[model samples]
Target: MTKGLDLHFPHQTGFLSLTAAAVSHQFVNEAKNWTEAQSHCRSHYTDLATLYNTDDVNALTQLGSPTGSAWIGLYDDLIDSWRWSITNSSFYGPGETEFRNWNVPQEPNNAFGQELCAHMQSDGTWNDLPCASAFINFVCYGGNDQYVLINQGRTWNDAQSYCRANYIDLPSIRNATENEKVQVVANGNNVWIGLYRTRTWSDGSDSSFRHWNSSQPDNLNGQQHCTAMSFSDAGQWTDEDCATTLPFFCYIADRPTVVTLRAVVDAADELTEAEIEETILKPLREELIRNGLPNSTSLRLRKVYQTNP
Candidate 1:
């Protein structure tokens, strides 16, 4: 365990396996108020790390010692319910509100009339604390999938919104092969994907299902709250805290053929011969000329002879 922090771990039967995946980063509450703590978390580490589910919580618990509580990135004051600072949205998963393991007692009791901090105790339960109390340190998970790279940088929330606005769900992997493909493209950077435990799909619904790699999506820390793709590893999927501001991946869905054409012109049928010649043929001719095709090539017009009168 690191000095003042109580970092615990699960018992391993064989050689203790310690991969970058198992390491987690946390922040300490140092007399900083809510807003200040939020800023410190954002500026220092990734955003306040949000728990995905029970599995994620368990994994994080290993990082603690036998004593002391750790602060997480969950709070209810900004919104009506518990929300992640990374996405600034409510935490999604099976039994969101009823999950006692994550929350001690339907809290956000807004206790002290100003409770906005959460900590993990030695027993693995969560307790709400005053934001100004400087007794807690938080944890962070860093892996390849926590971040997304784009032409320009953006917040995880922005990345998620951009994917939803432009594509189907965030990018999803159908199998290990696809995951490997994504990893190759990602290189060493983390990217976002379309797999979250927001809700289960309906019976017979194909679009909502996720095919995780074998032995994957262990929901490591708590609930497998966030989704990321690993490149150094086997392009496998890993669950992470959403607030961990790592890079994210974004994708644009294939637009309908008609919509694509309309984007270039008002409508395909509305294009005039002159317009086509000016916009299409002229450009092609210029490109051909640039490529060494003869610009002066000409053809003789054929005429038909009249027979009568």
Candidate 2:
């Protein structure tokens, strides 16, 4: 009887199916060059996609469909350095070791000078190539905050000026969320933000208020005082002095409220609109009326919008 009896079992395939669905949804493919790819990823999909670990990369590989090369949001121009195109920080896990394919000396001989471009090979390893090379198909990721996209394509100084004229201050990173948000927006290109250590906030003199992720403000072997954001390292901040001539980030406070007529026109009318404001409006109005006008003869009654209360 026991041998003939059947037992019910839970279907485990559902979980695998769900995982496959998720992997399929996160993959993206587009055709373009480095700049064009960046633009397409930022505009159509997400600003910058994140590669947290090997699993994420694997998921992306699966989503790539038909098994061909695609451009990822990662690259480095300096040396054998690797960084995320969004934050420009070196925070990717060790899993990337299995995915890297160095050309010969395993680093940048700077052979062609600035020929720094990384591409995903069919074998799933990354390789450096000349940026001028045309390629098709790019992958994108989701999960980034909505930030102001400044496509200045200008040098760092000009970019700073543009940010200042339009916003409150250059971009600032208070926490990881903001960092990721910026990274996602920039995707795979270098951008600027509002953080630097040129002048000390305390005395307006050099006091070294530089904040960095690791041995940063490393100045990379020099005393770099200004800072700029790189898409290579997950938006991690670094200082390189103000004269480095890189893009900058600016942060604008919310729009200010427009002045109202009633707010400007006070009881005394003695204090000019400039003098009386929200805090000082009533007090100055009272004080002016109490003190009275210095030159009564000079005062002329203008047409009143409302009868004097």
Candidate 3:
């Protein structure tokens, strides 16, 4: 719906129609803190990426290394306020978006300082980390339905830049099946998963789907606020500091579009009833064919006339 971007698909549920769309994701090889990472992505392509289904996670995993973890677009801005990538209040309820799979008792202790970035472990759990600590890989999501996983070691900010330049921004994971798919690909690496408190999608969609490990989101130590995926227990989650930088993933979207087009012809300018078909109706048919529309398509047109208004 924007410039230089078009949505194209044979058929899609609840969407627009266009000639075609160009959606995709990329993997960056830099690092920075969570905030910096997001900024980097916004400056270049769209924003941090967000996930929707199993296909999204699985596709991203295929592009990533089966070792390290990547950054996604999830964080815990509030102590107990959890949200998704999209900021639509009406889409999800209080308990609807609260999906966490922490490793329990040991994670989210806020061990260091202000942790606010989310990541995924190779195993597919989650954790919260500091936004400006050391360095970790990261990822970004954009476009229609797309994702990417990078295999670089940098701070969150650095990773964001790399993604923006090469791909989109960090990605967001939406459902459990998607989480599991990502887990299988992680292969025991601590990658980033798109989840956090007060979540919002890069494309601004409200899809409620969470897969936290067991006894997670402890928000321990009051400092641990960010989120991440874990490897120890089937891709669960844990709260950590955001300052700890890491690698990440990025993506773009070009989802299939479906549009309903209609035309309302004004019959007020018609001729006499006796001359109707010959003067107005028959020519309309010829005009459609002249315009290059398929004859079959035109033949399917339903004949309807406004009797009142």
TM-score of each: 0.20, 0.22, 0.38
- Computed on alpha carbons, the lDDT of every model, listed in order, comes to 0.35, 0.34, 0.49
Q: Candidate 2 at 1: error in angstroms? A: 99
TM-score of 2: 0.22
Q: What stretches of model 3 exceed 4 Å from their correct place?
A: 1-22, 79-198, 230-237, 254-309
RMSD of each: 27.6, 29.3, 21.6
**57-160 per-residue lDDT for model 1 (tens digits):** 44444544333333344332222334222231132344343333334456434442334444334433345554444433332212234323343334334544
The model with the greater lDDT, 1 or 2, is: 1
Q: Per-residue lDDT for 129 in model 3? A: 72
Candidate whose TM-score is highest? 3
- Cα lDDT tens digits, model 3, 1-309, are 422212221221121122223446565657666666667667765655555444445555565556555556666555454434433334345555566766566565444434456677655667777645345555555435455556666655565456545554444455575566556555566765545434444444333345455666565666555555443344444555667675555555444342233334444432222133334434544564466532212221223334334
Candidate 1 residue 79 C-alpha distance from true site, Å: 5.6
Off by over 4 Å in 1: 1-24, 27-32, 78-309
